[model samples]
Target: MSVSNSPNSIPCLLLAAGRGERMRPLTDELPKPLLTIKNKSLLAWHLEALSAADVENVVINHAWLGNKIEEALGNGSQFDLNITYSPEISALETAGGIRKALPLLNPSDYFLVINGDVFSPNLPLQGLLDQVSALRSMPNQPLAHLLMVPNPNQHPEGDFYLKDSKVTNEPLDGAEKLTFSGIGLYHQELFKDLELNVPSKLAPLLRVAMAKNRVSGEKYAGPWHDVGTPQRLQELNAAHE
Candidate 1:
């Protein structure tokens, strides 16, 4: 799908509320997003990526060492991005965290969401926008569009299947499994009828949309890493550096 060349002012929500259980000691002193990679914090790198894509506003949710993260990157003016924090007493899972940050997101427009701990090659933001547009064009469209990637070494079976640009929770027969790339474009409609203050998992909500052929996706054949473990982070840092 072709996307418009003009840069869009899409806002981004970065999920930084994890406890980093696998990155214990390192995270004991600092949040995983604050870990130095080539003298730059992972959070900083993500901000730079967003800025390069012309994304201006960013909502970051935090819990572990949350205050320190806010102190380190105040208002995000330094990165040419406006930053807002959603402080949570208890770390909410992806869906819950996003719901908590909804107040900071675009009130009536589609926005971007990504896992804060993972790293990926320069994202095709335009392609994501195209998917959102396509979904909105259809009658009674879905609320989200995901960016998927071919199965990585760690997750060979993958998390979900993609066929004909639609997502499915059901395992496909002899289908090439693909993993979610931790990056997505989402419309506010996904949470339209959701009650506030209730914890939710994004997967089930997405699956519902997929069942109706509302959720859309595109396979991204690019460098992607889900740095969920210390060993994996070390390997990625070494290889990328």
Candidate 2:
């Protein structure tokens, strides 16, 4: 199933408002999303790929050093994309950030969300888009379809288990578990009930949906890195070079 090229047909929200406390002095002056990997800012890589996939409208929410993010990306013309900024005075956890950006998202039934800090060079955006497009015909549409990856060394315990494409917080005997890759296709209904402007974590919401079998996921065994620390950034840069 080919995705439509229409502008904003499938809008994406880049979660970039974290404080980056672990990234320390480096983030003291620069927001983590603007941190460079192989000479390109992390968020820049996302914008480039998203544009290539014909996803034109992107909402980037920023808090710390957000002015720099705006100064760096402007209206996203260079990337052939329309960028909208959702500014936050302080970091609003994942769910809160998405809720606040709802108005700017064009009120799509479903939208894509990607964590600004993670790096996945081969993220299959088109495939995920196609899946979501197909789901529109289902009677019991899933609230979200996440991209899961093999647990990285930093997170050995993993987050959720996947069986028959369904995501669950509970462990299934003999089932291989994977970590959430921080990339997903989400239906607006999943977030419609949340209290706006309040700090709320996304995990709890996902877990609740999972219990009802409303969340689906797929494991991606590709180049992926959760660039949470300075050392990891250095390693990713060196590996790419």
Candidate 3:
């Protein structure tokens, strides 16, 4: 399961359309994705990493301060990648956003998706890419492959149970349960039936797929941050400083 170092073969979608109500004043004028850490915008970190991986094209969906995102990362030529934007008048929830971007993302069966607000320096992009490449030849491919992480203090209850690399909504007696890291590799068929321009969440879709054993996941134990509040953002920045 060897994939080319060039990530151009796989397009990436950065989900940046969330209205960061928790981030408040900082997000009043800037989108959460534009918030800075170590003096670099959060989305910038993703762009740099994708560029390093040689991911040629990236599609970003933005709503709050969407224009600023465009202004800040135009064409992505500076980062060695082509950038396309899907503007939303209102923040379309995760599933909706991905559904809206399908036309731009067509021709490819699977794509990489990452939440713009998370800071995971050690995200296993190569491993996920290799997995997706292998799944491409399977007769019944999984709808998604999630990167799960230990539940943070804010979400200790966890989301899904992972057993033998498969994701399930039902908790198994001995399987480890973990939180969705907001990072994943998703196949287009996952959102094929989603209605256009309607707000929808990703969890429901994932749960349905989980029932069919169409989802796979891996636990990631690394430097991962769910930059939800201003204090956490400041702390991350200070640590880097």
**How would you encode candidate 3's per-residue C-alpha lDDT over 150-240 as one tens digit per residue?**
9999899999999878899998777899999999989999998999999999999999999999999999999899999999999999999
Candidate closer to the true structure by TM-score (higher is better), 1 or 3: 3
Instruction: Give all candidates' CA lDDT scores.
Output: 0.79, 0.89, 0.89
Stretch of 10 with least lDDT, candidate 3: 1-10
Error of 1 at 189 (Å): 1.9
Estimated TM-score for each candidate: 0.90, 0.95, 0.95
What is the C-alpha lDDT profile of model 1 across 1-241, one tens digit per residue?
Answer: 1122544567789989899988887888889988866677778878888877767788999999999899999999898888999988888677888888888886466889988887775766656755655665778676677889988887887888888677788866654568998898887777776666566778888888877777777799977778778888788779878
Clash count, candidate 2: 0
Enumerate residue pairs that collide in model 2. Answer: none
Clash pairs detected, candidate 1: none
The positional error of residue 10 in candidate 1, measured at the CA in angstroms, is 1.9
Sort the predicted structures by lDDT, highest score first: 2, 3, 1
lDDT of 2 by residue, 1-241 (tens): 2345554368999999999999998999999999998899999999988887888789999999999999999999999889999998888899999999999997559899999999988677777777866667678788889999999999999999998788899988766789999999899999988888888899999999998988888888989899999999999999999
